[model samples]
Target: MSLSLKRFAVLLLALTPALIAARTEPAATLAPEANQAVTARMVYGLLSDSRYAYAPRQLDAALEEDILRRYIEALDREKLFFVASDIARFEGYAGKLAEAIKGAGLEPAYDIFNVYVQRVGERVAFARGLLDAGFDFTQDDEWRYGREEAPWAADTAELDALWTKSVKNDWLRLKLAGRDDEQIRTTLDKRYANLERRVRELRSDDAFQVFMNAYAGALDPHTSYLNPRAADNFMQAMSLSLEGIGAVLQRQEEYVVIREIVPGGPAGRSGQLQVGDRIAAVGQGRNGAMTDVVGWRIDEVVQLIRGRKGTDVRIEYLPADAGVDAPPRQVVITRDRVRMEEQAAKSKVLEIEDRRIGVIELPTFYLDFEGRRTNAADYASATRDVARILEQFKADGVDGVVMDLRSNGGGSLNEAIELTGLFIEQGPVVQVRDASKRTAVHGDSSGAVAWEGPLAVLVNRASASASEIFAAAIQDYGRGLVIGEQTFGKGTVQTLVDLDRFARNENQRFGQLKVTVQEFFRISGGSTQHRGVVPDISFPVTLDASEYGESTYDNALPYTEIQAVPYQRLGDFSALLPELDARHRARAAEDLEFRWFSEDVAKFRAERARKTVSLNEAERRADRARDEAQREQRQAERRAAGLALDEGAFDDDGLQADERNVVQDVARQKAAEDRPDPLLRESAAILVDAVDLLAADEGRLAARVLRPGRTSTVWAGGADR
Candidate 1:
């Protein structure tokens, strides 16, 4: 029997809840709306359909068990709430979730959430009580902070013991930060209260989205469900013009953490805000009192941070890994639209050993989708801007060009092909494989070459999806040298399906689902799925490939190969690679900036590898003191080297020394904009090496520059000659 049909049959035969229920209904039931039921049905129907990239796995008892486990994990990722007894009680419904969803019965999911909320309330109350009692800093007891892989507590007594240690840790952090008893109590009371309030505020839709996403995520990490409000937020994010501080926020425990800073956005250019920083409070204008946001909903916090364009929004944040009692720092950002100028392709000329090399930093493969559909002539795109940059480079008589795609998370797929077309005359860029195994080749038909000169593409671990496509095409065609670390290996394409479209009623509002529909492969027959494009020349990076790429995701599609598409190759770069690598290595070893970067990366990796933190108050204080001393020493070194120190270089308080110093702000921005990027500089040097190598090999050099009317010098799929 078909999996869907069997699933339906199982649901019909197993509608009884007697096996799991101790009561007739949950203590607090926030029932799903009728529209939500319809939405759930539609979502399941779509996933089971042939359009999804992966084949539909049978939603039988075993799959249902997996979904239930995933849902629980999503709700309490760190095993902070819900004891072993709670988990055991929920397991009765593990194999029955498929049946429940089949009949649109969402009470089980809501019941679990209701219990989670109650648990959170109880824990927060206990934490508040402990805060009042204070902690003994001299105690030698340790706290295992990393609990994601740990088991749940056995009972309330066990949970109480855990909460005691957790609360004590928080107290110790504040005590070390030099807070007196009353001050620590005040801060922690508000934090716990916010947590309780946020948990109590969870609506039916929030629970539903969380549970449904668990189901979708089990199939693929990239596939997700977004509720109506979240759907709107997603669209706004894609538009890249939100009137906010321009940082994506997520709730992490009691804090709203900065997930990503939108490029070209206020926070992106600020040089103060960073990913993983916790937003503790937000205020309006220059003089508004900051309101603490700990334990607040992400959307509510976002509303507080967002403002009208050009208006100032003040933010107070705790640096990532900064102890709970670490003084919060504040920054004032003038909210503005995240326009193309911030994310657009930017050009700079670098003089490498008397040869002028042009560098274009492409932050993302962005395109104005709405404008293009409306046929707006002024529409902006990465390819168009890059073409202009190449023209300017030609006019300036540059020897070579470096396309920097470092830290580029990728965007429009069409732009990737278009950008690749600017380097090669005409060829296939990537191939798309759908659910049914049918493959369609996407190629660049534009015959015009933008810059037929020496080209090198620089990428890093964050460079993903569309970035991978462009880099792969360049390497495949021998059109350019791919440099830096391996790409992020996200080769799948997702299509957002609005649930409202499939609803029966016109007035009914349903959420959206971002479903993975296709996987991309390089024209050379290799899939960039879990094995991102390997660089021809590698650079050292601190980020572990296993921890950061598509491989990190459970059930990610494996890498494979297909028949190679026919296309012309530019020239052989094999002989040139050795000379290039040797020169680059020697230069990197001798460069002070590179040495500093290497040391910083090593330190970062070492810190990340430490899963357990010293919980002893004295040890932690000593460590913090040592770190502060080192930071001051670094500042002194920078001063000695004649570099200007940041205004907050030595401030213990979170507030900037001069909040309204417009001149200093502008100077800092300019300095950041004009700062020499070590990686980019190295890439340009590598391109110069390529130029010199080609200059010596006249025959191979002629092959690159003297291409005759898109003729094939080498087969696209075959080994390079």
Candidate 2:
């Protein structure tokens, strides 16, 4: 039981024959395979000794308490299964994890989880019985769905009452989804059984993964522990077939949440799959019975999801904006390989009357590393693709350009920097601060400018990482106007370390650690950690920043700043914002599309704030009818205005088209072209306003970067359009 750093796998957990796809009942005993103290010591040593972590600290009494608290919260999210007595009984483990880890004395993690399993088993049986008792949907009662912040129940009686409502809520959801009483009974009964089975099937390795993750999460939300079995399963899946409903899944509390949707993938093509949506159940084909994956291990969930191409997979999910009490909506995605072309930067011109505003849609900051290394002539690079588009825009004599980054979850860091370089002639783009307090300036030294025209960068809550870097660089240098919602505030960089690399014994398997090693900063010095790049002129957004962005994570890093770097200032968007905002607001108020978008956003915002739902059948049905009528009314308006197809066969506000029907596709595409995006048009309008404003006051405008001794200003011609 030595706490030596050299024995990296000293705390490896005993494994069962379960290869992640099986759900057999566990054998009698769950035991440890190696020394926890030695493994903990090694893992901590790597963390503390890293030259990059934000602030790796010792496992002192204070940190130990936080770790224990995090572990408890992870096990009993929503405070459902655990009673006040259970938590009180585990209080002795508080401020004791550090000592226990160092001395190989920690038994509290397993003990608490064991208690959790028993509690879940009891709750499951009670919930199943509640279904048999039958729910009275006629009652005008409200069911409280979210209880993450609620205090633990004082006694089992209180817990039973809570479970009763929870079970009722479940039954009501199924009924709303069109299930009959018998069908709802059977479905809910199976769901409860699955929950119980999942809890009982928690292997020793699964416990270790959860406990270590709690420690990591106490430090920062981005920090994580990836168990070896899960990693192996993913690798095997990737090798076997590159087919699936392409959505990145991550374990959050008891549910698996969608982290990102791969462009051109089945999930993205379906358009219903969204980032932050929680997966409740999964099924194969069109009508297969869904297997409850609420509390299943991530690998098991993955095994069910990734399958052969052209296969239909139904995913029942809680919408990103919906509360836990909301009825689950399912989407059937036909799985296929992701097409890289769909992810590349593409261009279009919004020709409204006399103005031709060039728009470039960059879904991600992509770079073909292999092609670049091999010097492949046809390789795809965001910078290169965008540069080409800018050249075309110039050739077409466009008025302004909008770099659309909405829903663009970032990719390559180098691409962000290089893309930033395209607009600015040779300057620092972003800065990186390592754990050792060493700052490195990463910039573009290409000494070339792609486009010097009036520019605007559009962003949203889903625009993160590399997207933030690009938008922040553009905003910091006054290079462009950042418009729309504040970006996803993910500024830290992480690297995965395989523990097996340090293990002396081949059989001793440790997991992998994803450590946050650095932070991203704009050239202007502000880190885009928790506080993302705020839009210069904002648009109406339904997503609450506190609930949707990095701020949602309790352990996200704080915003900080370093010394500013030297860069030439372009035109000042701040000075023109007052007039620009006034005009924009006036236009938005008058525009029918903008008004409708705002109305929808308002409705979603209201729905998001609802913590409880009416159980009354009449009330629920009335609400449903009202919502449907509203949607139908909007559809009618679109048809009346010729914004929709003449046949009225298309919905989705003319945003999506049926590719299979060529005639309908062309009509829908035409309708889509006719239907202008309010935000994008507004952004282009702002950029145009900036151009005019700059022309009115040339003294404040520096459209071209002037070198110390070079005064050609040749790039200034890009603004002439």
Backbone clash pairs for candidate 1 read 328-654, 329-654
Off by over 4 Å in 1: 1-29, 139-142, 168-181, 242-358, 392-399, 504-508, 628-676, 696-721
- Across 382-490, the per-residue lDDT of candidate 1 in tens digits comes to 8988999999998998877899998898888888999998888787999998888899999988788888777889999999999999999988887878999988989
607-698 per-residue lDDT for model 2 (tens digits): 55676767787887777667667667767887777774223223222011111122344455557555547788778877776666555555
**Pairs of residues at least 3 apart in sequence or in different chains that clash in candidate 2:** 10-35, 52-435
TM-score of each: 0.77, 0.73
Worst 10 residues of 2 by lDDT: 1-10
**lDDT, residue 152, model 2:** 93
Q: Candidate 1's C-alpha lDDT?
A: 0.74
Count clashing residue pairs per candidate.
2, 2
Reference-based lDDT, each prediction: 0.74, 0.73
Off by over 4 Å in 2: 1-30, 35-39, 50-52, 99-106, 197-202, 229-349, 354-400, 409-412, 450-452, 502-508, 552-555, 645-677, 688-721
